[model samples]
Target: MSEGSSSLPLVAIVGPTGSGKSELALQLAERFGGEAVNADSMQFYRGMDIGTAKLPEAERRGIPHHLMDFLGVREDTTVAAFQHMARTAIADIRSRGRLPILVGGSGLYNRAAIDVLEFPGTDPAVRAALEHELELRGLPVLMARLQDVDPVSAERIGDAKRVVRALEVFELTGRPFSSFMPERQYVVPTIQIGLNGDRAELHGRLAARVHGMVDAGLMDEVASLIPEGLREGRTARKALGYEQFLRVLDGESTVARASEETIVATRQFARRQITWFRADPRVQWLDWSQAGLGGAAEALVANSGVAGA
Candidate 1:
């Protein structure tokens, strides 16, 4: 690493769900006197603990955590908002002479925290107009339009949510969504670590975790959110565990059926996350079970040229 690169150190722990990322990140924070920051989108909402698998205050092991449970479910917190918050958190942690450890499974959030991705400023009117169009014309129509204007971006963001985002940019700026995004160098030198395991083992773990969540009153959690007027909130309505529970609540499915559906959805999400992270060339992939916490921490520090505390 160059001298300039050596000064700004950020470590990121990324992986599919139930891959032990949170445990590894907490251990690293304890070992290096680091502060933990949430990079998972779902974890940003307050009162979304069990479903998001958030670490409780007691389980935080006395280390300070940033950006988790800081926003309400109804609030519109975008990637730009997260970038701003994470930058401030990182600066604050560094000022206190502590390392910043970003931990979560959200690949986009992880990239925003490390790379200097330019986000177009939020405009509610623009978002509302685009969302109206999406509701009218459907995602396929918007995706077709994106393909015509910016095939690269359309390919990169080939999802309903992303198609809406692209349309929002186009409506807001009268420019192709891709035009505003420039290739960026990392603003903070980062050690990006990805956790992996045998595909069968990962699937097994995911199923077990989903079952555990159900056993731990995931249905009650969803019921509480609904009565709090979160039934229409984008964050709460679409959360992995909460969505399936909603189905159960509506009598559309049995509890067993909901659990099965949740596991399937989570597995699909994990597959997408793996695909996204694998495409990023900067991440160093390792099997979490094989490397263990200590080895992974050492590897991250050594790769980033960050001396051990």
Candidate 2:
């Protein structure tokens, strides 16, 4: 938790799933000497390319990207762990006198990298009781309690595993989970650039993107990962495209059906991402379709009040 050098500004490109944040980051990095640090949780897993929409090496345009394609599918990654690693990467990039361009749609991941948010440690004794409560009073009761205490987090989190963990953090920290998420206070000097455009247009783009992923061998990707214990990993098993294709492998659906489901799931995820980023007032939104978008962003970063960019 050492203070990051303020001489180098941290630039983050964030927005909905199909908002072209990744491409924009690449453009900005090329324009302003910077290295991209992956904040997309799914892209961290190796061999998860087609489904995660991970850019290939040739497409990276020779720019350095860190925290990407390193972990095995069966390995689990925690937010605290990712925060530590991302901060380390950012520090390293800054020390080398280059700007760190953090790119991803994962709200918590991006926040962990640049914001002053802290992750509470688990209390096994408290966690066990919450799990027992989840088993006894059912998810609704636990969710209601969390809603009463941390509605922001309750609204943000959907799956039971996360809900239970949120409640645990509340109990262990003796504070509302939402209270931990104060307004946009940067842990490092930063410029948060958000990319977005027409909703219907984005929906169409996401649908087409999903179909393209399937054509790029997503089904084969899932089938190949089954032996890698992808199904055994709590987080990896639930990734948008991978989860749907996993259903196809389980004989519960067809490739066409799975493809459609993946599109819908990705679209919904995009909506949630939009909501999450919209809550942060500090974000400077840029139209993804703007002409000379890269040049505009580069100018903004280079001329901004932050001492160094």
Off by over 4 Å in 2: 1-6, 124-141, 305-309
Q: lDDT tens digits, residues 132-193, model 2?
A: 98878898998899899899888788766788889998888778777777677898889999
lDDT of each: 0.81, 0.86
Q: Mind giving the per-residue lDDT tens digits that candidate 1 earns over 1-309? A: 222232648888898988888888888887777789889999988888888888889998998889988777776577888888998898777767778889999887888888878887657887778778888988888888888877878877755677788877877777877777556467777788888878889999999999998899999988887766668786567888888888899999889999999899999989888888888788888787783556766666866666646
TM-score of 2: 0.92
TM-score of each model, in listed order: 0.91, 0.92
Question: For model 2, where is the 10-residue window of minimal lDDT?
Answer: 1-10
Superposed Cα deviation of residue 89, candidate 1 (Å): 0.1
